[model samples]
Target: MSRHLIYLSILTSLTACAGNSRPAVQQDTTSAITGTDTLNRMVLVPGGTFSMGADDSTGMPDEYPKHSVKVDSFWMDEHEVTNREFAAFVAATGYVTTAEKPISKEELMATLPPGSAEPDSSMLAAGALVFTPPNHAVPFNDVSQWWSFIAGASWQHPEGPGSDIKGRENHPVTQVSWHDAQTYAKWAGKRLPTEAEWEYAARGGLSNQIYPWGSEALTAGKPKANTWNGNFPYKNTHTDGFENTAPVKSYNPNGYQLYDMSGNVWEWVSDLYDARYYAQVENGAANPSGPAKGYDPEDPALEKHVIRGGSYMCSDEYCRGYRVSARMKTTPESGLANLGFRCVRSVTHH
Candidate 1:
């Protein structure tokens, strides 16, 4: 059956049962673990030697001087943590995400232009950047053209106030910062994977492959992952079964039984943000913890942290960070619709 038809059927069933029962919790629980336990939680990625950075001529300048690095075995989340999973953490711990707090008036005024209307409480409240469809094509380099600061858009209320998880409990929770991810990891007795560990898991035991599924194009006869298919920022044909992020396990897993390691949402890592950190790491068996301090030339006010994997919004025209080597940095406090995370645990045979 066509994907549209399937979605329609699912939507129809959901609507029919919306009034009679708590379908969200039921569907979420079932969808959350539809795949193998290895795919649903962390899988031990046995470490080995592999080239770390990008060597391709088509690669970006920052991903230069590809070099080999050896990583020790580590257990990494096979899939990005889902909304339902994160909600459980919040329910158990009463944790407050960074984005859920109110933004100080001084901090809010700094970003807004002088003579702008007095900021409303809602406007000054900390929220995530939600992508709004632009009326016309805009330069991909300028994210402000498409991304808007939506008030009250946290992990629970993803698109802002009045929006709830509802049927999206199985989807990866967005608007989570690095600190928020770490808190959840600690609560779950896990940790954020290091840059080396994340890359190792993303490679899925494939040596130097461009993507998780080897060098094959994203789609040959069928769509591979959730990514832009049509004119980006204008019309998304959603040929890949979704325009935005699909549910967890919606796509095929890599060789290591990991899902959504490429697209869907960019995941947080434990490393501090440093563009040239990889170049300085010792060639041998050192567990490198990025730079001593986090830094980013783009926005230096707040400390930045490393984020891996490109998001569903990533496109060749804009951010082509879908590859295993692709990396980006964001403030530890910054969260957005495309930002989420997974957890990792150290492997030890009992």
Candidate 2:
């Protein structure tokens, strides 16, 4: 199977989108930026110039053409947006998430290959993608071995009907699409971090370092972040004291007091994903917002957005997605079990 299709198969829910509620967040900034989480919950990222993308050959092709870029100071959430937090947003707005809505026949047909037979209506029901680890080792080429689209797998029931966020409210919310994240950001009077802003904040004042905390290998010392520690898909050592998502502050914060910048769940960013975008940025450009439009040659039909911070599923063998300069992309509408996001606000002028 092709690379994009492999991830698309594993990352996407069988088909659908759907609901949310809301609450309040902001508690500072002279009451101007109301409806956002408190400034106490955020850290001010002092902006400066730094090299974006991989400094060496360790990163994937998309992270290539390491170039210098500058960004402005901004307020960033200290940790991934928690389930309790997202719950508040949903409670107040009564908004629906992508996973809870049904998929249109045309939308489902668009993903199928030409001349393919249409799927039955039952197969187009509302759902979300989930990570289902197999009992035995399987080839990585076919991600379907470990992922499946489960009906009713919304953020509230991430793993399906029997699952709930009861004890995991402090954990980052999953099964959230880029659109969902954007909606929450807007309601909170914030926005998703741009790719450049994300990378800059993730670096935490250190340039060219590997992980958010530093160059120390994850397995070299004390547990760093929540990630797969054994054979992926089949076995996990639980070395990080977590089988899946960890509570937001479970790990140490980076230099900027940012938590889970490297692991836990992938974070949605404002930038569109273009495999060749880094090459387009001049080495010394200031505040590049990412490609005007995303173009993934492998999956030209789908529009993809940048997602940062690896997840509990990342490993040394399959992915070092936690690396400071690492990058990945997925469609705006798809939600998964290990993908969530945070918000960043431009400095309030008040």
Candidate 3:
């Protein structure tokens, strides 16, 4: 059988085991205090300043003109929000994520090229990206290479209608857009962290480190963060103990007690994306929000929003986006298997 089929079988077996158990399974509350819970529940990240952006060596043009940013203290979740926590929110609020809704025929047609096939009826109706290994090489910039507009893919049915969050309760919740994240944040009496705030917290009090763990490569002579460790789009040795998303807080916390700030999943930030936003800030302390209006030439549809802290899919050969300074622009309406979020509050109040 193919690796994908085998993976699906394993997941299916695990799901069955999960579903047979009681809904009120006790989580490791003790670990939660130690900043090691899998629920994406994190200890507060006491925020402070460090250089934001990058020095000349980091190739990305957008990370150019390295600058300083001072961020006030804040209380941040130790990890990205997880399926179990998001399930509670949905159970309480009856919240329906945008990914759960079908794309209208009109909207689908508007987004697709003139000759593209109609949305696949056999696939999950509304789901997020699920990092299935591709049979061939594909472009990273063109999301169509790996992302399938699966139906029935939402916080509940993460892989699609046939899939459920049973065994994956501790996994980070995917298929969540920025709007969905905001809604959950409000419901939880929190809000999305501003990009500055997010970066500062992600730094975990480390100074000028490439990742939350510092300048070491993810492998770093020993198994480190959860990330791809093999050739892209074909094999995943599972060297990091996961081929896709792992349970939240599965790894070590950064210096500031924040978990998964560098990997596992990419997180949403409040700021709108502007490649030049760093340049505009230029070592100043204005605490700037992105442009008042949203459209940018790089992404005309304005669908893209700021996403930081790359996902399990990140690899040195392909996307080194897991770095602390790394930033990616994603569609606000777009949800992917590797995309999830955490909440934050101002230290003074929360």
TM-score of each: 0.83, 0.90, 0.81
Error of 1 at 252 (Å): 1.2
Q: Report every candidate's CA lDDT.
A: 0.71, 0.80, 0.67
What digit string (tens of lDDT, one per residue) describes model 3 on residues 148-251? Answer: 55556677877777888889888888878888999988877678988878877776666777877777768777655778778776778888788888987788
**Model 2 lDDT on a 0 to 1 scale:** 0.80
Model 1 gets an lDDT of 0.71
Best by the TM-score measure? 2
What is the C-alpha lDDT profile of model 1 across 195-276, one tens digit per residue?
8788877877777788888888775766667777777788887888787777988888877788899889989999887666
List of clashing residue pairs for candidate 1:
none
Angstrom error at residue 299, model 1: 3.6
Candidate 3 collision pairs: 42-78, 124-150, 124-151, 125-151, 125-152, 126-151, 126-152, 126-153, 127-153
| Candidate 2 deviant stretches above 4 angstroms | 1-31, 34-40, 106-116, 348-350
